[model samples]
Target: MKRSKRLILLPHCVLNQNAVVRDLAREPGSLSGLVRVCLEEGLGMIQLPCPEFTYLGAERPPMDREEYNAVAFRQHCRRLFAPVLEQVTEYLARGYRIVGLVGIAASPSCGLFTTHFRSGEGPGRGVFMEEVLAALEGEGLSLPSLDVPLGYGVDAEETTAFLARFRAFCGGHP
Candidate 1:
């Protein structure tokens, strides 16, 4: 069997902007630029589940970390992410290099480096991301994770900057 050199864990919303709640989607459908970059780099990609979507669905109102950081929500995230962790571990065991994750900034669930809470955005980990990181730590695994802004359409220059950062994070070139 062929093995990929790297695996990229992406937030599901990156692949399906339409799945996001109202006024949250950035691109019309998918973040094609990022997707194309990943394909060009020959990186294997895994679209991680949207915890909010699984728990509340597409029509649910947007929430901040304060709203989604309940114990029940954390437990739900762990349960929802169990299979993903298993798959990542299996890939590692099979000699595939699991590179890192690309998360959405300001997301209450999947944000990697920055999250939204209490009507403000700040430097923090999202609930789902926290759970995933904990799981990875428990298994003695570490991977680089980067965050992109939430609304890709809000600013062209910001989007370009994000893409540049993402490319840099993916090993300096795309």
Candidate 2:
């Protein structure tokens, strides 16, 4: 059988709630609904490293984007994404289509937009995502991206909206 040759970059917590900060994990397991859609669409998932978990560990307190925006943390994001960048390039070389990135909407380190801050949620890419985008940009590559809000799956309505947006991102024939 022919391979699907399609992929999507994802933050680790999306696939592993175990990596989330204790109080913030809303799901009992992986986001099954999201995963189901991806599988149905034949989009392979690239689970990126959990920068907060790896840098601060699972037991650490919830932190915000400003707190994680230190020199060392930024450095770590760069180091951690190196191999992922290589993997993306390899897939590109092999003719795989990277559909886009799916990021947590309210994360401190992995949010693509609407990140947490000491004050409250605000708009911006999380620390780790900044590095990922920069690295990809340096290589002249960019992926269309979307965010699954923290409230995702809390209601059928929200989930429906995200799925619709996801389908549009996946594209279609002219």
| True lDDT of residue 159, candidate 1 | 78
TM-score of each predicted structure versus truth: 0.93, 0.94
RMSD of 1: 1.7
lDDT of 2 by residue, 85-163 (tens): 9999999999999999988997888888778888888898899999999999999999999998776768788887777
Q: Which structure among the candidates has the greatest lDDT? A: 2
User: Model 1, range 88-147, lDDT digits (tens) per residue?
Assistant: 999989788877888888888888888999868988999999999999999999899888
Position 76, candidate 2: lDDT: 96
Which candidate wins on TM-score? 2
Local distance difference test values of all predictions, in order: 0.86, 0.87
CA lDDT for candidate 2? 0.87
Give me the runs in candidate 1 sitting further than 4 Å from their true place: 1-3, 172-174
Candidate 2: Cα lDDT at 137:
99
